[model samples]
Target: MFWDLLVLVFYFIIVFYFGFHFAKTNQKEEDFYLAKKEIHWFFLLLSLVATETSSLTFLSIPSLSFKGDYRFLEIALGYLIGRTIVALYLLPSYFSGNTISVYEYVGNRFGKSPQKTLSLVFTVSRLLGDGIRLYVSSLPIAFLLERMGLNLSPEILGMIALTILSIVTIIYSVVGGFRAIVFTDVLQWFIYIFGGIFALGLLVDKLDISIWEGIKNLQTSQKLNLFVFDYLPSGDNSYFILFALIGGAFISIGSHGTDLMLVQRVIATKNLASGQKILIGSGIVVLVQFILFLCIGSLLYLFYSGQTMAPDKVFSQFIVAEVPSPLLGILVAAILASAMSTLSSTINSLSLTWARDWGMDRWFSPRTLSLFFGLTLFISSLVPYFLIQTWEKGILEMGLTIFSYTLGPSIAVFFLAKGKAELPVSGLVFSVFFLTSILSTVAIGLGFQISFTLLIPIGFGIQIFLVQISRLAFKKN
Candidate 1:
């Protein structure tokens, strides 16, 4: 326990020291939020990976692999393909103007109301979705530590972890801004990826199986198959394959293309070409990272088949139970680093969105912006206190599902904005309000899942038809 605390303290010190070091001198809003838009490609690529990957993958991907096999790669492929499309079409437009918030592009292309509405949606979705995500990501560690006589309450343990993470992340984000976040994220990515690979090698040794044999076993178990139509839910119906493909694509666009957290790296780039490169380079990095983690997950399940009670804990438990104390310390550091890297990105992104889109700079005085930021973070953190849960998912699918809501409304906003067609503000509001209500209620309450094919068509159909009707009515008059 003493050793774990020592390592955790040292790791956090490095983060705070760097954050304060960067922000020690004069501080400005642009420097604080956008890092003065002077980031390099390599660092931006790393930040992109860190922002998108999150700490959840560290624990969850291996758990998924333990349950099945390479089937998870299908989701990775979807994101890779989807991001490539975004790199070509969407990124250039974001660069076209010195846009601060990506959703602002939606407003410029659409109108004020749509932009503001989507910004609000992004904030709500991320805090609820990613807040729960952050909570769940730390649960595996808390569970394993408790079992080892570290004996902390899960809620208490989670809070302690979140507090450390928030402080370390906030220091750099609030001070050094995007540049600090990206540079640190690049450093942390290597720690996370390398630590995961090391754990994977250790797991394979314990399994008494070569990695190739494990692959063969997983293939024979049908965990390797990407297309699973065996049990179709009502919404997916007969079009399961098509649904998987389309839904994956839409979810990816909503996440990588529209979400501000993911786009911050692009916005920080020196030029449009650099931004495009960051998107493509980061997309490839994510693909490789997903494969590495998924393979580790497979190895984890194979080794610990009957020994562990919960499969979710297999990956982190191996680090806690089997790895030597010093190495264990390093693993914990890596996990916290991963978590802090992502949380910092989230806070900075949320702050930027609020400050810019909400007109905080103009509407509020300097003192008010400071107060608003603190208040917003305080309110956002309250989410995990009430709603964190322990459900598990594969790294890719888990991210996309959380991403759907964040991306969905923004997609509608951007599509309208880029189309530059006059959309009825009333109709736009009604369409977003209705779609959000139905999707949230059905998906959460009734447990109904609609495939992307149906959801996208319906969501866009309503918005477009309303706009067209308004146009015709005006002409007729």
Candidate 2:
């Protein structure tokens, strides 16, 4: 216990050091958000992966394959194609000018109303999405706390984990800004990947069965199935294929393409070519990473045959049960750090977007900006804590559902590239898009049979359609 606590404390010390270390580099406002140092494509690649994945991934992916098959690989395929499209098409548009955030492009294309509106939308939506992600990502660390025999209820443990993540993230993010976020992202990516691989190796060693026997287990259980493009019956247009590929692509287009948090990273590269490399490259890295985690899940199913466990609980309990103390500290640190990586990214990006795009930097220092957004981030994250039970599909789907909400309209806003719409008109278009998205998500939550994935296209289509119609309706007026 002493060694684990020591290592965890020691690891956080390094994290704080990074925050302070980068604090020196941020002399200017832009430096705080978009560092003056040149970042390599490789750094951005790793950061993209780290920013995109979180503790929920560590907890839920294996659980995904443990209970079901690897149809997620189908979604992974869409993610890959989506990134490629973003790299080739969307990124070029974002890189044409030195915009700090994508909403600048929105402002330039539409007007201040659209720009400020989208930035506010990004902040609000990310408040929900990243807030949920931060909460779920805390689960594994909270599970570790439970194993340590803390005399606490589950709710208290959850808050402890969330506070640990948020504070650590805020410490570095508020001090060092985006540079620290990117560098820590790279470091945390290595840490968590090693933790994951170690878990897989440990599991493989624990299983006494031969390769053939393992194959037999997978075959007998029918867990190896992938690529199910199941369409809903009775002319249900919201099919898995539709959701998995088309919906996946649109979500990716919106997320990687339009969302300022990630797009901030993409355009941070040295050149257009470098930006393209990292954007497309991250998709491959993530696909392989998903296969690794899903394999861990399938392996866990074989290890605990005939045992019933909640999908999200599979990896956490295994770690508490299987991993020894010395390495336990490192893995625990890794899990918490993975969550911190994303949380920190959210904090920095949100603050920078607020400071620059919303013109808050005019009055606030970078540190002040980070602090304001970081505190708001922690507050927003708390909103989902009590709502966790309602998301029955567990953390992974909940996180994705949150992404689908504002992301679709955000993409739809980006697609308004050709003409200048009036501020009121743009606002109305955005309102309609977001309204449709909110209604669709609520209907799904109320047990509507439609796929939640359609929220992306619905938002995208609604905004684009309404804007086009307005353009036509007012063409001669």
User: What TM-score do all the candidates reach, one by one?
Assistant: 0.85, 0.91
Clashing pairs in 2: none
Q: Which RMSD values do the candidates have, in order?
A: 4.1, 2.9
lDDT tens digits, residues 199-301, model 1? Answer: 8777766788777887787777765665656646444442355555565566667677888888877778778788878877876787788778877876676
Residue-level lDDT tens digits of model 2 in 391-421:
5346535555666766776776676663344
Error of 1 at 72 (Å): 2.5
- Model 1 C-alpha lDDT versus the unseen true structure: 0.67
Best by lDDT: 2
State each model's CA lDDT, in order: 0.67, 0.78
Candidate 2: TM-score? 0.91
Which residue segments of model 2 deviate by more than 4 Å? 229-239, 383-400, 418-448, 475-477
Off by over 4 Å in 1: 24-26, 140-152, 227-241, 306-309, 363-402, 424-448, 451-462, 468-477
